[model samples]
Target chain A: MSATNRQIRLAARPVGEVDPEDWEHCAGPVDEPGPGRFAGRTRAISLDPAMRGWLDDRPSYLPPVGIGEVMRAGSVIEVTASDHPDFQPGDHVVGTFGVQEYVVSDGRGAMKIDTSLAPPSTYLGALGMPGMTAYFGLLDVGALKDGETVVVSGAAGAVGTIAGQIAKAKGCRVVGIAGGPEKCAMLTDELGFDAAIDYRADDVRKALRRHAPDGIDVYFDNVGGDILDAALTRLAMHARVVVCGAISQYNNDTPVKGPSNYLSLLVRRARMEGFVVFDYADRYAQAARDIAAWIADGRIKVKEHIVQGSVDDFPETLQMLFRGENVGKLVLELV
Target chain B: MSATNRQIRLAARPVGEVDPEDWEHCAGPVDEPGPGRFAGRTRAISLDPAMRGWLDDRPSYLPPVGIGEVMRAGSVIEVTASDHPDFQPGDHVVGTFGVQEYVVSDGRGAMKIDTSLAPPSTYLGALGMPGMTAYFGLLDVGALKDGETVVVSGAAGAVGTIAGQIAKAKGCRVVGIAGGPEKCAMLTDELGFDAAIDYRADDVRKALRRHAPDGIDVYFDNVGGDILDAALTRLAMHARVVVCGAISQYNNDTPVKGPSNYLSLLVRRARMEGFVVFDYADRYAQAARDIAAWIADGRIKVKEHIVQGSVDDFPETLQMLFRGENVGKLVLELV
Candidate 1:
């Protein structure tokens, strides 16, 4: 076991795109697990677009990560010591364990994840919070019907990839909008998406008109901006726009562009709804079971882009999400 | 009957606030009703903020009022001649009869209204399209619950007045935001609202915090823009915002200012839904019945600002709505 813990702390609130100056590296003596607590080493840390929203000093689903504090993150940790009833040494757990080498927890929001069925990193990706977000956001918030037509933005990213695949699994026509030709090809060729539009190479509105000629019934929007406005123009009657995340706008110095064509909701009798994955805490286990079954049956493929690095690599790893550099789930695997 | 019918034709599309030149007063030969059709004399024409939206050349719930065409309007009329089975002379009816002294229709989308229950002008105000807009926009689109905190903007206008009363009747705590002290006072004292905020005099966000300290559960928005941003900031968990109209933005030559604080929707796990009243065509009868019962029981009050004038007075009468000069439902009663 390591004698010291290395951690990344928020040095300042990000103005627009996060800079290296916004983070600080720190070292501290490792503490033993106290009574009714467990100590664990982080094996993998999640790098999500949602993390950008947390860096802003504004009201959100979660409180902003305060300056000089350990940066808040979702990570898979392997228990090294335990003085709690629920946890034992060698058990793998998933929780909001900050960007650090070691963590001590009282088992408040932690759940033991089985590593035999899938690797520890899968718990931080498809089998974890992102997976739950895609499942509930599409099924409950989006109110997706079986034969509905779905269009997903940021379709090569974590939640989008899972959401599109799940829509396909439900017998819906799924169209994905990703940044590049390779990412777009991966969506149609590997992820079972019916059509994929390379947003970088084509005019998204015209491409959408070609691919979804009937109009989008369920729009799972992860990247908001002009693309959202285009999607608004092509909404079918009673369309459901699921506001998952706005990766495209999160790094903007200016205000987030509200969809100018949002009034389309009135013409189509449609609705746009926003939700947080934590709101579906009670349903996570059931969703996990279903997702696990799909993976076992080869219906839903698990996609991860794991970066082998130390805790100091988190800042650059996170920037990759905003740059549209990584595909599927992007995570940092502590070596 | 007069030798010619007096009519108002659209001379040009309004740039910002509508001008007198946008309308041209003309006299035309009154056509006789053909087989299965009816002819009627206009008694009262409804003046609405929605009319401003119809003048802009954009895709909306309804088509733009084309230049050189008879201006589209809703009016109460008395059947002067009929060959249709559903109507006869002396019957008062309500329909889209345009801005003309006389109308000929094929009995489609026209309803015979009983003046004995309410005045003929009431069919152009509280008991007509405005009433139906309030009914479904609140209960259905806003998903209003009995004990919820409801806040309404443009609280003294046609749909706003009706929507506030309906929310109050549903056992919800209602707060209204209006432009002037008189309109604000009418909301509380006459419309049975729990509180009223004078947006012209006081800061709306501060007033909303005072009135809805628990945050707004349902927001019935008519005058969108800054007020919509304020409402977004004060949303309670799982709140619903019904986007009925945006009278404030309809006259602007610049692009509409999208709400900068719309990310609040994600923070509160809330939704903002837009709806056009015409979509509930099948349920209008049921809604009208309930509204009539409420009016008879004294739970809902009828408020109308009637201008005694000829058809040529439409340009100025319509301007009254944009200037916020009219108290409740604005209508032109030809004298």
Candidate 2:
């Protein structure tokens, strides 16, 4: 076990796109598992677009990460020491453990995972927060019906990939919108998407009209902007627009561009709803089971973009999400 | 009855605001009621913000008014002659009978109204389409709960007045937003809104924060634009934004200004939904009963801006709605 731990702390609030100056890399004494607690070494850290929202001094589902604090993150860690009865040495756990080499938890929000079922990185990606987010946001908030046509923005990303696949599993026709032709091809060729629109190459509104001639019944939005406006113009009657995340607008210095064509909701009698995944904490186990079954049956494919690096790479690695440089779930795997 | 029926027809589609040149004032021979049909003299016409949408060539809840056609309008008419068994000469009926001195109908979409309970103009205001719009849009689409904080835009207009009063009748704290001080005052003093914000005089966001300090549970949006954006910033968790109309953007030559702060919906876990009141047709009678009782018990006050004029006045009277010149319901009553 390492005698010291490396950590990345928030140095300052970012104005627009995050800068290296905003993060401070430092060393700290590794925490010991005190009474009723367990200590673990982080194996993988999740890089999510939603993390950008936590950097600003504003109100959100979760409080902003304060300056001089270890940045908040979801990670999978392997237990090295324990003073708790439920947790033992070598047990893998998933929790909001911050951007650090190690973690000490009292089992408040930590869940032990079976590494034999899937690797630790999978827990941080397909079997973890992103998985639960796609499940609930697409099924519950979206109110998706079988055989309905679905259009998902940021389809090459974490939640979008899972959401699109879930819709396919439910017998729906799914169309994906991503930045590049390679990502678009991966969506249709590998992920079972019926069609894919390279937003960089196609007029999205015209492409949507051609791909979804009947109109989009459910639009799982991960990247909001003109793509959202495009999806709005093609909504079927009583369509559901699930507000997942806005990766495209996360790094903007100006205000997030609202959907100009949102009034189409009135003409089509549709609705747009937003939600946080933590709200469905009670049902996570059931959703995990369902997702596991889909993966086993070959209906769902796990996609991860793993970057082998130290804790110092987190700030730079996170920028890749906003730039659309990574495909599927972006993760940092410590060697 | 006059041998010539005076009519207003759509001349050319207006680019921005409807100009005088967009209307054609003409006279036509009054047609007799055919088999199983009825004819009536137009008594009062309802001037609505939705009329502007009908002038634009776009897909909407209803089709646009074609050129050279009698401009479509909702009005109350007194039956002068009938070949239909359900109608009588002295009975008063309401329907989309267009902007004309006389109307010939097959009795389709026509509802017999009781003038003994209310005046003919009142049927075009408080007991008509606008009234039903408020009833369904607020209670159904808004999912309003008793004692909740409700914010309504365009609160002195037809639907706004009824919506504010209905929220007040349900024991909710209602904040109204209107253009001028008089309209704002009328909302609080006469219509029973708890507070009022004059958008023209006060900073709307600040006013909303002061009035709905705990956050707005339901926002019934009649005017979408900056006011909608302001309401969005003050939403409580699980808030419902009922998209009823966008009178503020109806006549804009530029694209409708989207609510820039709409991502507040995600932070607050809220929803914005739109509906056409016609979808709730089966429940109109029940809602009308509730609204009528509230009015009778003095929990609701009816305010009308009646312009006594001939069919030639239709074009000018509609401008009052867009200019925010009239309070409560704006109606053109034929002499």
Best-fitting candidate, scored by TM-score: 2
lDDT for each residue of candidate 1 in A171-190, tens digit (9 for 90 to 100): 99999999999999899999
Could you tell me which 10 consecutive residues in candidate 2 chain A have the lowest summed lDDT? A119-128
TM-score of chain B of 2: 0.98
Off by over 4 Å in 2: none
True contacts kept of 1: 0.64
Q: Per-residue CA lDDT of candidate 2, range A264-309, in tens?
A: 9999999999999999999999999999999999999999999999
Question: Compared with the real two-chain complex, what DockQ does model 1 have?
Answer: 0.68
lDDT tens digits, residues B1-335, model 2?
55899999999999999999999999999999989999999999989999999999999999999999999999999999999999989889999999999999998889999999988877877778888999999888998999999999999999999999999889999999998888888888777788999999999999999999999999999999988998999999999999999998998999988888888888898999999988988888897788788889998788999999999999888998898999989999998
RMSD of each: 1.6, 1.2
lDDT of 2 at B332: 93
Residue pairs clashing in model 2 are: none
